[model samples]
Target: MSRDIHKKPFDEGTKAKLAIFRDYLREWLPVFIAKREIYWNTINIYDFFSGPGSDGFGNKGTPLIILEELNPHFDNIISKKLNVNLYLNEYDQSKYEALKKNVSPEKGDVRPYSIQIENLDFKISFKSKFPEMGNKGNANLLFLDQTGVKHINEEIFSKIINLKQTDFLFFISSSTIKRFAEHPSISRYIKLNSEDIEKTPYHKIHRLVLEYYKSLIPQNKEYYLASFSLKKNAGLYGLIFGSGHVLGIEKFLTTCWGIDKERGEANFDIDEDKIQKGQFDLFTNEVPKPKKVDLFEKELKEGILNKSLPSDKAIYLFTITNGFLPSHARKIIAQLIKENKIQKSSFNLSTKVCKSGALVTQVKPL
Candidate 1:
């Protein structure tokens, strides 16, 4: 039930990740909250691994970060008289108390948020209460920012993924999984039999685990996955985002590329193009070089050759297949039209244009 019992300072990589997650929520919350106008009446945000409000070294954990990000949105929602719910769950006693204290409004502080702070185990809390949350017609964003993968087993993930319009940001230490890929306690969750674990290359274990878990998700659901890795020396841990909607995936990748300047896309494998020895660039955003741009353009052309894909579906296929952002795909699709390699049957070639039911066809060679 407990993670590494000893406490340590929150590393810089973790802090950068927290900032990226916060920025993503800052952009996504308004759009998500406005869903009340079209689809849902309420938005529920669940921070399942609500850590001790801070690392005790001045660095705030996910719970405090999420609360701060949501405060302004909460006020806006209240002004509009719409409902938004915050569910914060922490199992550890001291951390739970800290989470509750941190989220509680001080004297005369009127923050219009319906906050439910809990001290129960996340699995039990999620399983018992998720039915109500799922049935409420709320767009739920569950943050499973755990210390490890213990609480995010197959059963829990399946339950959450089955809920309607729900998205999750799950944190895991790939180093831990690589070390324990053959361990009986964890092997079953990743669907790795003892034999497969023994035979699989260590470098490939993370992909195997990710793909296995992804396969468990419902096939009929249009799910998109993107992972952002936080590197500490040779070790890497990161957040895996699962969303049933394309917009969710878009925002997640946008955050990933924004935070990690050394890497353009969300690739799980460590890249040879390492960042400066001791530097982390949280501010600089280097545009993809011409080489990478051409690679993506080539993939986009291959995506629709001889196939008449709806503009929206083509973007989805191109993005998923190439690991480029949706915007990247749109840019390449536009370039293709200009070069006479692709034709758009309807609207002008643009990011939002694709989703307008326009038909896109690859201009086959004569």
Candidate 2:
């Protein structure tokens, strides 16, 4: 990819989201590769709406960022001779050419990476190649980083979710959906019913869409989801992450909360906080207090009232369900133990090495 193409300039919010994407892959790929080492020989990555290598201002786009993120592990991967497949798609001809040039290894670049660039419409291309993309014994990560919600319909989402060992990250413009809620075209894309469109509050549309998407997934298949709303002030977009494992949701939420700890938009009750912390003056001396934690504790108590889970499973449940971190779960459980409200098999279990199933039961108030 020539760095000279006039590319689109990413705003501060877009940059933050891109950084989150990179960080997620950085945390996930290594762990995923290790876990799949026993069963798979290849790791396949797909970016359906990959843009040119750089923006008009010459800033690296998602494709280049993905390449950069993967380059560091070449030495380790090459030693094992593990096949790493990269499939990037760009509908624009100029961007397609640039993406090919950018991902092609330059001189002295010793990375043994298999890269394929497609210049066709992503929806059509993905549909035609869906079966080949999801080969058994190979793990896949699809990045449907489209410009908007035009192509991400139910068909694409269901196919990806149903595919064996495949996970996905995509962007959704909740603000746009809310703004155009009444429009028939927008309602069709978001799958909003007439009743929902008429009766549902605008603020609740995003949550409804999320729940609807989750409901579409088959019940037998387990998926852990995490989402982050970006630039609430600007009302741009939010990211939705769906993974086949609990660890994936944990890592994604960890990154999202780490980035926006003050509000915890991805996992916490940010709407209430935003309403309460509405429009503070810069000159004002008052500082908004942190949001309360009692809600999370209550959630934990209910989930663990009378449960026997591998300690890891308990942590995963609370984390994904209530956006509590493992540390927070441990703290809440410790408090319950202290109050004699709950009983645990042992107190020595740590989050990372908690392999044994821990039996926990709530004590009845006599």
Candidate 3:
């Protein structure tokens, strides 16, 4: 049996992971709430592995954090008469009872939104709730905080890929996959090469797992996936966020970059960038730079000069897809303009700009 995490006070790593979930929800709720009449009229949120509402020290878990975030939106939800549903499920019987007691409408004051607390296994819960998620008028957010990496197999992920207006956040014990790469049970779920898993650095096992999932995306599809690695003690766990729309990716990336400005991918310095020495340019002195940002900037500059990124819209997509914010891409564009490599153009890289048909000028090379 898997160990229970809520028996103890939530650790820093778990807190960090929950923080991302909370922050993303803060950004996520308003979009659908504001658009209740205009776009999606209903919002569905699922926490598949919700624990008892809090840890031993009473630090709020995902269920409580979610309610706290949604509390502020109750007025808007009430005014618009929007249909918002929250599904919180815990597989463990003990945890489920605790979840019910803690998350009861009377206790949490979550009466404004329709909420359901279940004690089903993830697979069963997902199967039952999936059809509701497929509704065209509903916006869905699914959080799978599984104890291990087995629940989100290819079969499950394939179904998620086909859903229209859904975004998902998945947690996995990536280090477990590395440690048990060759195990028969593990291989059955994720078909990664044992040799390759062994060769990957310990800290990057989570990223490797994410890459495996990325490979599962269909070539013709335009899905976006990003990862945030959490280092807990000696093990590495991570969260993978997925969405079909650029706006969803934009929100997630914003939350991630806010947490880890250096890499926008982890709680710690995953790249050991802080210790690395900056190469001195004989002509000009420069401060040490972050490795990931430097690499992304170099690629962004090359893509523009090569015409691979030919317009603001294309650059905007490139920026988010490469796990960056528009501001980062704009910084590169600013330098390019100063160097006379590209002609001046409207640097408005917002999705609204794309929809408004304003980003028409092709990036002219000088």
Candidate 3 regions exceeding 4 Å error are 107-110, 275-284, 353-358
Candidate number achieving the greatest TM-score relative to the actual structure? 3
Poorest stretch of ten by lDDT in candidate 2: 357-366
Write model 3 residue lDDT over 151-191, tens digit each, in one string.
Answer: 99999998998898899999999988988888878899999
RMSD vs true structure, all candidates: 5.0, 5.3, 2.3
lDDT of 3 at 253: 91
Clashing pairs in 1: none
Residue-wise C-alpha lDDT for candidate 2, range 1-366, written one tens digit per residue: 012223447766677778888988998778755454446667888888888876758677788888888877776577767788888899999888877887788798666778888899987779866887677778788888776566778878878777776778898767677667777767776776657645655544556567667877788877766677665334646788888766677777778767876544543354566534455546865655445355666656775665444344554565565555676677866777777866544533233442345543333321
lDDT of 1: 0.67
* Per-residue alpha-carbon lDDT of candidate 1 for residues 1-366, written as tens digits (9 for 90 to 100): 224421677767677668777877876787776444646767888888778778877788787887788766765686666677888888889878877787788899876668888888876888777887677657888888777667778788778777887888887766666677677666665555556656655544445556666778777875777776666445556677887776777777777777654444333324444445455556655433434455666756665554544445665656753446666666765676677766554433333534556554433421
Q: Residue-pair clashes per candidate, as listed?
A: 0, 6, 0
Candidate 1 Cα outliers beyond 4 Å, as residue runs:
1-6, 34-38, 193-205, 262-269, 274-295, 305-312, 343-366
Worst 10 residues of 3 by lDDT: 275-284
Error of 1 at 190 (Å): 1.7
lDDT of each: 0.67, 0.69, 0.88
Cα deviation of 43 in candidate 1 (Å)?
A: 1.4
